[model samples]
Target: MAKRRREHLFIETDGQVYLVRDRGTLRFPRKGEELAFPTRAGGTMDFGDDVVRRLKPVLDHHPEEWYQRDALFDRDDVDGLVKRAIYNTMIRCVSEVVVSKGNRVLMVKATRGFSKGHWNLPGGFMDYGEGPEEGVLREAEEETGVRVVLDGPLNVYVSGFPGKPAYSLGFLFRGHATSEEFRPKADEIERVDWFTVDKALTLTRNPFAKWGLVDFFLQSPEARRALRVRRHGLWDGATRAVRPTVFLDRDGVINRGRKGYVRTPDAFEFLPGAIEGMRILQDAGWRLVLVTNQDMMGWKLVPDRQLHRIHEAMLATLRKEGVRLAEIYYCPHHVLSDCACRKPRPGMMLAAARDLGVDPRQAWMVGDKVLDLEFGRAFGCRVAWVGPKEWRDRFAKEAAEWHPDVVADGLLEAARAIAGRPEGPARGRGAGRGAGRARRRGTARS
Candidate 1:
């Protein structure tokens, strides 16, 4: 019988050994086979020991089945395998999607694994060689026996196992399921049910569910329409470019603004009626987009991972209130930077217009500051200012200089004006080309 090939690396300090070999089990070393390079003890394995140096050359010539216990480092062999080694360690792919229909979303109750009895979105890891859209569709079908069509990406979560070398890149998609009734897989899921936005929040323990459903889709009316627009096939992913858009500011408009930076999710609280305003705009054929300046990232006040968490929390909170943002665009540059995407610069707006296939000239920008108005003007968009009396007074001084096309007390009023609601004072307000400043002068006084 042939002996199984194995590789070994010895550590003398604590009398521990490391081994790597091919096995059917994909987990780390078994009880008898511990191969982790780093151990609990602060012991460093030195390959330059005299005994290892003597056996180095012989070990290099042999197949890579096992490292000689006393082998020294071999530069050429190690160099050749670096690319292959690194490739083996990196794992990036979409895992699943949360499918929504109006205020309700499909959630499967877990029957096995560590999530036993807990509810989560219907999805699993994408198959090898499959695109994200395809994988999500397949997983949705396999897990819940329901067909769903992809709308677009909601968010990309970058995560990893505590001790694993590979990373998990999860793409959360917003989709509409074709069938409401589904039979859960006997092993993976106990049952499937449609949970309302509020119910899902109370029942779901999964963070992604909180991030994707509770914070995003439930609040977005346009997204809800996209999920159910099968009658006309408008959401067949082809004719989305012509949709109208409403660009929103992050601070002051969607959430409370402060003199200091909102550096964490704890500091991020929604302004009253912010979600309702977005929902109103979305129902009126306007896709809600968040275009914000997060200079905190560039100034190193917050890291990207931390910001990612904050955005996730924000989305989760908004979703809880039944608001769905079409997309979010953030410029991480500091004020000192000349980057185009920063507020008062049209870079982010232009990028969003191109990416979302929306007409920038027809879009409306809602913000509380002069920079927001400047950004809208630069993008050829009509602007709405939602500010307190002090800020409005300040903006009034600039009415003759350059002002927003409309001024509203808050985001809900601004949304009402954009939606042409009868209750809105700005309904029937029109800002002709080169006449926006003049219109603002009259509106500012009123």
Candidate 2:
């Protein structure tokens, strides 16, 4: 009988997925060769050639260390992108419990592990062939020397280390320790202590611990209800939840974006064919969401009440046209503010996904500026740009990294391109996924 190959974990970020073979070693699959990574179900998936091509430039600088242990996973940040793809090859499945005594929760200082020396909840890697319930009970006793009877799961947190090809899907449960005393394992834990929620806030270094504490203590009843819906398999994973939505930028794509802000209802003018274009998208079964940058409002150039009225009018106009927008979210900060929700930051898109049960990777973003295109790309969405000929031509030349999937003269043209296709992101307009001219904007009237 042959021994089965041990599974390893692979990580894909910003479209670059790489594999590390040994737990503590660094290894890269061959270039221009068909390769497979083990999946969680004991199957293998083809790691495509495109992944190899993107990795070559980095390999040239450290050819000898390509297969060295911890070569790629030890960095602070793998360039600018985080781990968006976490393959099950080397994933760790663990379970932790929040066993609180009075106002204090149980915490242990880890003597070793990925988060060694950091204060973490009582948990460890789930041994193969054991259920999560069995694993959590066993881990609690093994680490803290206190047997626990778990009640119900508080929440599940999926977290990954920066620049490491590993991730943990952890189940946090609320339980009570059988004994109030504890003896820390000499190898795995330094000490077990009870800390108040406020004190735990300062000591807990693990992201999952912090998240679990918030879910247990700080989350409102309404938020808890929302969390239940999210936890019930409406999402695929922690990173990308699959919801079909059309993320639209307000000023340019919906209305005629001008030099100054659209401050009043009178100034909120829809561009020609904008209403009909929205109707076409709605008919095609795409959820409409408005993601706009209203930096003028944050700067006090426009009052919040007036801005609310403007959005109300926009929504009312769409409803009159039989188009229902799922939601409207705007970033009210200056371009220089560097707020997370600003255009190009992807903060609002992520928040929308969490709030609306939408999947960004499977959605579309239609906008008119370079920032908008970048924002779509950041969230793994298909992008369509609506702009004048001169502006489109300039983007194609200078900002290819932010190249849009489709280019149109206005909202109507962009909508036609979107509706003309089946359900999918618009491929490059006659560009063949490389540098080429966008298809000339159609002249069809709305």
Candidate 3:
């Protein structure tokens, strides 16, 4: 009879049973070497010479179990084993770190494995009994020889290959390097270098790594300042006690409107020319602030953290295009809740005025819906209606009543017209005493 394949060897030591897997064959750890025994929960425990000493006694007690002949497999048993093997799945934990110094970020070129010859963040598969944070720190040191001091977690990314049952869950972290010098691991890393955020984004080949860089760009103060310099040059140090501001609506105006809601980052997509329009406004020295109604939160359709993740990705994309928002405010009340901050109420605008120290009268409110127009009118700001002609025709009576100062094809056209006007408040339908009275009445009611 052919010998049965011995997949694992059992070792008993100190009243404990340990398993040593050797890929369908039994092998003992050599002197000064340690063997890893994987636990039932997918973690591993290491055992060395102490366990090795008891191997002989365990083999002596279970000689038949260890050296048993290959059992004849019936068709039903073989089929069950094949089915289980085919359907079994496993999730691997991976951790990566984005190490930064001033305006530069650290990245490594890989010499081996799947990402060979491409640049990637310094990280690897997590080890036994290590959490993501601890694993990332170890990986950073192992690959780049840099001790990273973690600032915080950035995001989690999941990846799986087609036709594969295993998936990898990656934990990304942001950190600052403790030392400038790098000693790249010779076996896995080709070299390490620091790069500007823009350059690093171009060099990174892994999608998950790129997402981490995007999050870093959004959260890093130094990176944001560097981006500002690249976009607008050095701030001339001119002080403006009251800068002109633009209050924007989020869903329909900034991103494509969704039927249900933008519950995930994957569902959020920028409308055509939206980023360019925002860039134009920013370049013209306008402080962009987002004011939106997010009733999804009130309805328990989306969690606050999930919504924040969506915005993080949104802001990161905008920053990539050289546009930065001064602030974002959203009403987390149900549509039927009569919340003061909801559109058509002046609560959000009032808060914006006090927080940003900008006059609502001098600001321009741009949105696609009629509630947005009414909100701007109530706040005593010039309003621009953004949509196609069909939409305008559909809401002709509301448009006529609201009398938006500008009705354009979209935000790009509206922004161009608004930016061309002279510095001071443009002569529009909604400004001065009547609008102020309207604002006062709205504030009083709220």
Candidate 4:
């Protein structure tokens, strides 16, 4: 209840009076309870005759989404209707991420050739069989030459530009200047200079991004703190150093595997985003590593040479896409075989982490199985589970036999969740559970 109380902010929603507060439900009935209006969307609520001049900017920031369901603003701007998604939505898209010393963030310039005319957190269109996370890293590096350390999510924003009719999501993450060495692609950036928050706001045209259109964004003195740029640097050995590691998983996380080990290249199926993901990591200067387990091979069900062939095929596929892989790791052992390389055991994860020269905890372990999380947890890596919640229910319960972490419907959702995407395109409803989950993790035995 303390997150918000009652406040009197007149809003124009079907005559519904909303007590717009700092960060909670904004719309309220005249004599009833206040309903959630939306935040980062705090712009339009203040657009009244009494304070027209005082809250014009806020009104302008009401966002185009509002018009999708409700009313419209009195005065219009070409940028109107095309606005940033709610701040919470932004968080959902790239909700949050980790930061380490010396990471590079792309400051893409708006060009006649590109989509916009201002700098956006660096990223490009999703590639065939590639997730957004990898695309962003690849785009950043292909545009800017610095190697990067992709830590975690930050925020997701939606905005519109002149002549553009659709909404584009912004996936921002915490990053740093990795090498202090950067060169922009031709016209990719008019001028590239590291600018802090204050400097960013000082930009000629604020790109009409989520922050520019809303009042709540820069309203609070504390809110404008960093100009919304990501954080950089972590102390180590009394000095700061660059840390870039592309975190990936084996099985569906990387090459291709489903329900069992894909020992032979013939069984390999690069699940959509595999190659592009690796490519993005490589261009971004992040050390690419595959943390995986090949248990079936131990049972004589899969072939080692086939595993190698699959990896070779994966690399070849990446090459065709103008992308490349950094490194590959896998555990060719079984759970009952008493070997430490199997998933749910940190042996493989630890080995991969050590090989990559990164703290297992700081690295990302993106996978489709419960043991994926187990290995990540065991080796001290941040875990990202990609799969339908229902598909994962039995597994989550099984994973209870080990630990808990983030879950999604494959690497794409994992990417959006990691990048902090607001809302995914509507999909089929989940059955049984109110949240539509078929099974939920309760507890498990080892």
TM per candidate: 0.41, 0.45, 0.42, 0.39
* lDDT tens readout by residue for model 4, 1-446: 43433332233343222232324433322314343443222332221221110011224334433333123223243122112211111121211112122222234564644445765445555554666577667766766666666755444445433222224444545544477577766666554554332223223232222232122222223333322211011112132111334457766665555666565677777777656555544443444556566667667786777667677776777678886444565666666764445555444433332232343323567777776665555443456777656778767677665444457666655654544422211123221113212112221111
The residue-by-residue lDDT of candidate 2 on 42-73, one tens digit each, is 12333331131222132223233233223444
Tens digits of per-residue lDDT, candidate 1, 286-346, equal 7677888887878898887787777789988878877777677788778898565677766
As a whole number from 0 to 100, the lDDT of residue 174 in candidate 2 is 81
**How well does candidate 4 match the true structure in TM-score terms?**
0.39
In order, what lDDT does every prediction score? 0.60, 0.64, 0.66, 0.45
TM-score of candidate 1 against the unseen true structure: 0.41
Question: Model 3 off-target regions past 4 Å?
Answer: 1-241, 423-446
The model with the greater TM-score, 1 or 4, is 1
**Model 1 Cα shift for residue 138 (angstroms):** 59
Which regions of candidate 4 deviate over 4 angstroms?
1-242, 255-260, 280-285, 398-405, 419-446
Output the worst ten-in-a-row residue range by lDDT, candidate 4: 49-58
Residues 90-198 of candidate 3 have per-residue lDDT tens digits of 3668888888888788999999987899888888788867999989888889888867899988877766653333467778888888887888888999989998665
